[model samples]
Target: MKLFQYDNFPQVTGSRVSLRQILETDIKDLIEISFYDAIRAETVQQAAEMQSKINQDYLDGNSIHWGIVDNANHNIVGTCGYYRGLDKGEGELGCVLLSQYYGQGYMTEGMSLAIDFGLHTLGLKRIWAATGQQNGPAIKLLERLNFVKTADLNDDEIEYELQK
Candidate 1:
């Protein structure tokens, strides 16, 4: 089935994590995750804005954003999305994880599922990710996923892409 065809976003499960739509109930968890995201949000208002934008973008036919849940405990650990907010017509991937869950390979596996869905389901030609220059783990994850350095988005941001 095509992504975003259901009332909720498509559920993509892996051995360690599952990707599904970030529900209203996930707001509390998202606030915690915001501490580790590029944009820091300490208040419910700020966090809710973040979550609202994600959902609103999807409803506007932008992209698929999923909450990364730890399969073992069913806890929301992070968020991941492909096409970089494009309408399934472009190729960019973005993700954020709780600081506590970092280095556990959850993002790697979760993003893999996203990339696979883009390739097999969306027929994307390539997928790219732009991350902060200081985000070593994110950079490493992109490299590990076989994404090549593409460009320098800014002094602090770098881009990488994986071609199909």
Candidate 2:
């Protein structure tokens, strides 16, 4: 498929979370997430840079990112996406959830929707993710989703993949 062929960001709905395009209104929540020490101790400037990269990646067809919003409160809880890979047929899966939401299955549902969109809607043959070696929760989530470890990116990072 041609890059950037998608005219609109897809809104994927799961039971507990909805994946939609990140809006300007989500900046505050994003900043909050960025400031969390466990996530990334980002300054305002750093947070803005991260937001800009997300926008630019979407515009350039390099990735598609979505804000993970709760269905009940409609609050942005985190973000996830499919980052285009060097191979056109594949993309990298990425996500972040608020610390409070960890182990609650919210991210698992959100990521399942994103992976479905990548494989079914986007026609991607493979979707992959990389997590820190010590990120046990992330590794467990990926494993539960049937992603297989494929590489050791470094001492701190490991890569996993799921093929359609």
Candidate 3:
């Protein structure tokens, strides 16, 4: 299904954060976040490639990506979104947060917003995520959100899914 035919992308807000459209001006911040070990866009060229793909993916109707922004200072602390899956009724969820924001509940809040949009608006039957097995906090957050551990993608990654 085509999930991004909007003139204005929907913004999902919580008490501390908002998931909004990624803007061109966010390139620098996006680059900085890539430096985080978890994200790993090590060079400026790599960061640029990542940014380009994000923009192109939206345009190609492959995914809807949002910047997870702080409400108070309006800084982009991270990103979360859903990518269309090979199956018609499913989507894959993904997220990343700066280290400082790790335990602050921001990614959880942002994820809740994204999941709601995926299930309700996109009418997806299932939303899933795959994370490095060592990412304890991420696995915990997915479990807290009712995602069941379904399989191991590899020695390093585990997959989880939430069904509608």
- List model 3 lDDT by residue over 39-76, tens digit each: 66866677777767776777777777899999999989
- Write down the lDDT of every candidate, Cα atoms only: 0.79, 0.80, 0.81
- Residue range 66-109, candidate 1, lDDT tens digits: 88998999998898886353554666788889888888899899
Model 1 misplaced stretches (Cα beyond 4 Å) = 1-7, 35-39, 83-88
How much is the lDDT of residue 1 in candidate 2? 29
TM-score of each: 0.86, 0.87, 0.87
The local distance difference test score of model 2 is 0.80
Candidate 3 displacement at residue 154 in angstroms: 2.0
Q: What is the lDDT of candidate 3?
A: 0.81
Steric clash pairs (candidate 2): none
Prediction 3 TM-score vs. true: 0.87
Q: Candidate 2, residue 94: CA error in Å?
A: 0.7
Candidate 3 Cα deviation (angstroms), residue 58: 1.0
Best by lDDT: 3
Cα lDDT, model 3, residue 24: 72
TM-score of 2: 0.87
